[model samples]
Target: MANTSFLQLSPRAQRLLKTTQDFVEQECIPAEAIYFAQMAPIGSTDRWLVVPPIIEQLKAKAKELGLWNLFLPKIYPEGPGLTNLEYALLCEVLGRSFIAPEATNTAAPDTGNMEVLAKYGNQKQKDKWLKPLMEGKIRSAFCMTEPAVASSDATNIRTAISREGDSYVITGRKWWISGAGDPRCKIYLVMGKHHGSKEEPHRQQSVVLVPADTPGITVVRPLPVFGYDDAPHGHCEILFENVRVPAENMILGEGRGFEIIQGRLGPGRIHHCMRAIGMASRALDYHLNRATDPARKTFGKLLHQHGSAAHELALSRIELEQARLMVLKAADTIDLHGPKKAMVEIAMAKVVVPTMALKVMDRAIQAHGAAGVSNDIPLAYMYASMRTLRIADGPDEVHIRQIAQTELKRAAQVKDQLKHKEERERSLRSRL
Candidate 1:
């Protein structure tokens, strides 16, 4: 078992985490039905971009309980000042219900965006955007993936941000941009190449803050995941044609998009993994509930009485526990040594948690038979969301490659040290 002694959170974080657990159970979980009803398409208009009323109610309650913005770390003096390890525990609680994260103001794209602004944004930029985002008054989008290039290699981004006088013109087509479908989405963090710049591949990219209503900017459509267009926070495809923004909107200066990417994505990936553990735990609960029902029997035995079914439940519990421990460890590392030093651990958690969650959800769905595939349970949707994580942030293969490289480098260093030690002993032996 992984040691959890290092995860002793502060009293403030512990109190907030308990409050968050209660809020998610009492408020967010019960509001799922209302959220689903409001998300359904009505008449000729697509209501997918509308935020449900229940969400606002929950958000208000969350603010009153002081459970808002828990994802922000102590580095940002203006935030709740929770460490990454502490926030990870709170995030797992929020992940139990789909509505909880947004209610607590810890939803992605926004969390990542807030971190970027807090770390890199100038005072004016912070005043204009970060303040509203932190307040949960408005949402934002991250536009980096391009339709034309393999976005996994972020350096392949072809969007152009060219300088002209006091402004920069941005032209690109970005897809899979989460949170763009929200009507409250007011700003975008767009990544593009600095036109005519001769900087290295990694240094050539820059991220700029572009207002959603900027001239020539258009939201083309929302992309569906396994036929579910995640309403009000849909993943969208957008176009920017000669969209102009003041040069001052550039984050951390020109040719520094990769730097921001590294800083923003490290924490974002771990947050997703922590949430995955929560989702898996819920799925396991659903599975156990169904499996233990005496009314439902298979082969003249209750589901839980069957040896295979019981084993499956036991395996899921073990997997979920292991995944949770790995995520906590990763969060602790990021908290202690900074994100750069924690990359290997983050990559490991990112690869492990989603895959484990998906498997647990798959077994849970199987336990429910046909109802699992239907909207009667949240398993199908949860499965789809968890499945996406394997490709999001960075794909499993990418993380695997990174982990392998790190391990191989360490092995090489050990081998060199052993060789030097052996040679030194031989020299001493010859003298004897």
Candidate 2:
């Protein structure tokens, strides 16, 4: 339930939510094993080249069911006109299964890239890339994280977008670029230093829309999380050596990359949290199912009958509900106020939800004993992804620092107010 009983969802969003729930549970979850089974073997050249057949089948079904691209919030005319709050509900359902996100064309890197194009790209850029992306005919990657510097502080990025006459020559190294390994990935929304910019340090960077097929682009290797390769769609290390595009490809003019990312990441952080809650919910279901399995009794009683396991289940349930409420609140704030206003809430959710998911899933794995760590169940893989969430988008430490800075914004006023209150209390005591 995610404790979201009070959301006043629009009729269309409500309908989509139900449909998404059914699709993820009945189709995506069940088809997961078949989807994996159909993949090219790990060491094969086709491993990254061939997507499993089951995924396309699911996509076809999802499109028929009117469940595609639900992540785009209603503000963008390019989107399906659902609010951020509405999509949060549907996104949780998608989180229950690994294949559900892409099946519905609501996966990350793409969703975020779509938003970037819709928000910042020109008409030419939109027609060539956004149209194909929104239609799911092509995929894209966001190249921002670099290996040489601390990328968390985005100003430290050294990738160069050098202008040569009427074209921009881009040269850089980026790693952990999601979706870069996909055959359908045809564009890259790259962020790099706008060469020779005299603006402030924060404004020295810019984003550009580079066609993926352009010369001098090389995918060096795929990066794995824990042990999972996530092939077909991978996180990759790529080199851009003098990749050239028309200067018009620069997004929203130079010196605006920081502003663009802030706009992109706010909603994205919430989406990640929503999906994590869904994963935690599925893990809790595993906990309950395994805890009550009659054939798997422990010490002559069902596992849940044991005091320790019972407590763990209760704790997980509480944490799940709390995590859900926090995420939904952040979503509603974004819908009501906009992403900039919801920064504090988004930061809190980003910091909390992924960690909460790991805790809940870890407990579920423990309940399953040896089967949890093995390939017999999905918990281990799910945990690996959930663990990575803590560092993705923006890591917990980054968000935690943000939360603290935001909280302290009112510290001076609060200190004065508390001092006044103390003085009044003393005055009242003296009069008595």
How would you encode candidate 1's per-residue C-alpha lDDT over 224-316 as one tens digit per residue? 899888877889999999999999989999999999999999999999998888889899989999999879988899998999999999999
| Cα displacement (Å) at residue 166, model 1 | 0.3
Provide C-alpha RMSD values for all models, in order: 2.4, 1.2
Best by lDDT: 1
In candidate 2, which residue pairs get closer than 3 Å at backbone N, Cα or C atoms, i.e. clash? none
Off by over 4 Å in 2: 1-3
Every model's TM-score: 0.95, 0.98
lDDT of each: 0.91, 0.90
Error of 1 at 58 (Å): 0.5
Tell how far residue 75 is off in model 2, in angstroms.
Answer: 1.1
Clashes of 2: 0
Question: Using TM-score as the measure, which candidate wins?
Answer: 2
Angstrom error at residue 398, model 1: 1.2
Report residue 273 deviation for candidate 2 (angstroms). Answer: 0.9
> lDDT by residue for model 2 over 1-432, one digit each (tens)?
454458777777778887888899999999999989998988677988998889889999999999988898888888889888888899998999998999999888888888988888889888988899888889999899999989888999999998889999999999999999888899898999976788999999999988889999999999988878988889999999999999989999988999999988887788889889998999999999999998987679999999998999999999998988999899989989989999999999999899999999999999999999988899999999999898889888999999999889899999999999999999999999
Ten contiguous residues minimizing lDDT sum, candidate 2: 1-10
